[model samples]
Target: MKWMEKVEHMYDQFTVREQKILVTMVLVVVGFVFFMFAFFISDAFDERRERIRVLRETVTLLQKNRNLVQESRQAQASLELKAVQKPPMLQGHLDQIAKQYELSLNFTPQKPKDLGENQEYQVESVELKLHDAPIKNLMQFLDQIERGNYIMMITDIKLTTRRGQPDRMDPVLIVSSYYKRSAEELKALHDKAAEADKGKDKADMKESTKTTKDDL
Candidate 1:
C-alpha cells in the first residue's frame, strides 16, 4: 500500500520527458502480454473447444444408435438358435434339396471354424462345384438353400465356361452354416442318442419274445 503511494508521488515529481518514457515502457509490456494471450493462449483454448465439440457429436451419434444396437443383439440370439450344430448334420438335408431341384451336387466341405467369441458356437461351410445345370434348377436350388429351415448364407458364387463346353459352366457356390455346440459337446450328445436308440431296440426285442411265447 505504501509502495503504491510512493509510486504515485514519484510519477508526479517526474519531468514530462521522463513520464513519456515510463508510459512507453508500460505500453510495450501490456502489448506483449496481449499478443501472447491472443496468439498462444487463445489458440490453445480454440483447440480445446473444437475437441470438446467433436466428442459431444460422437456421443450424440452413439445415443441415436442405442435402439439399433439392442435390436441387433436380440436378432443375433434368435439366429444362433436356428444355426446348425455341425456341417455333416446338414449334408443329407442339402442332398434332399438338390434332389428336389434335379441338380447334381459335387460338394467340398471345409473344416469347421472355431468362433471363439462364443464358447459354444462355430462356423462350418461347404463349397459346391457345379459342372452344369438348367437355369431353373440352379435358381430353385439357391432359393431352397436361402429359405431353408436353418439360417444360412451364401458367401460367394462365380461361374465360368470351358472353351470346349460352352453350354456347361463350372459355378462355385459357397454356403456357410453356424454351429450351436462345440465338437466335444456334440460328441457327448451323440453318445447319449446312440444309447437311447440301443435301449429302445432291446425293449422291442423283449416285447417280441414275450408275444411269441403267448402265441405258442
Candidate 2:
C-alpha cells in the first residue's frame, strides 16, 4: 500500500503529456509480456501435438507388423498340415483314381526333383496319357486327384479331340505331389553320398598304386 501511494505521488508530479507517455510505455511493456507468454504456450502445445502424432504412427506400424507375423504363421501352419512326411506313390495314386473313374491311364514317371533353396521338400510327378476317354470321366478323374489325401496338383493338362469321336478326348496330364523331408533325413542322405564318394576315391587310389607297382 505504501509503494502504491508513493508511485501515485510520483505520477502526480509529472506533466500531463509525460504522464500520458509513461502510461503508454507501461501498456506496451504489459502487452509485450503477454504476447511472449502466449507464444511460448502455443509452441509448447505444438510440440506436444507433434509427439502424440509420432507415437500414434509408431503404434500403427507395430500393429501392422503384428498382423504380418500372424499371417506368416498361419501360412506356415497350413503348409505343414498339407505337406506329407513321405512322398506318395504318384503312379499308384493316379492309377487308383483312374480306376475309380473307369478310365485307362498310361503312366510315365518323371524324375523327382528337390524343392526349395534348402532342399527341404521333394516333388514327385507323373505324366499320364488317356486315350479315347470321355470328357465326363476325365473331369471326374481330375477332381479326384485334386481332392486326394496327399498334397497333389495337376500341373499340366492337354486335351485333344478325337478325329471321329467328338465326345471322346485324348488327355495328357502331369500330376505333381509334394512331400517334406525332416532335417535328420536330409543329413542322412548327405552322409550316405559322402561315404560313397570316399569309397570311390579309395578304390581309384588303390588302382593307381597297383599300376605304379607294376611299372616299378
> Model 2 over residues 114-148: C-alpha lDDT tens digits?
88877778888889999999999888889888774
What candidate 2 gets wrong by more than 4 Å, as runs, is 1-76
Candidate 1 lDDT by residue in tens digits, 1-216: 999999999999999999999999999999999998789988999999999999999999989999998999988877765674334455676788889977788889888775654445667788887767766677778877866446677888987776676565667888877667856786776688799999999999999999999999
Candidate 2's TM-score: 0.62
Cα RMSD of all models vs. native, in order, equals 13.0, 7.4
- Leading candidate by TM-score: 2
Model 1 TM-score (2 dp): 0.59
Worst 10 residues of 1 by lDDT: 81-90
lDDT of each: 0.79, 0.88
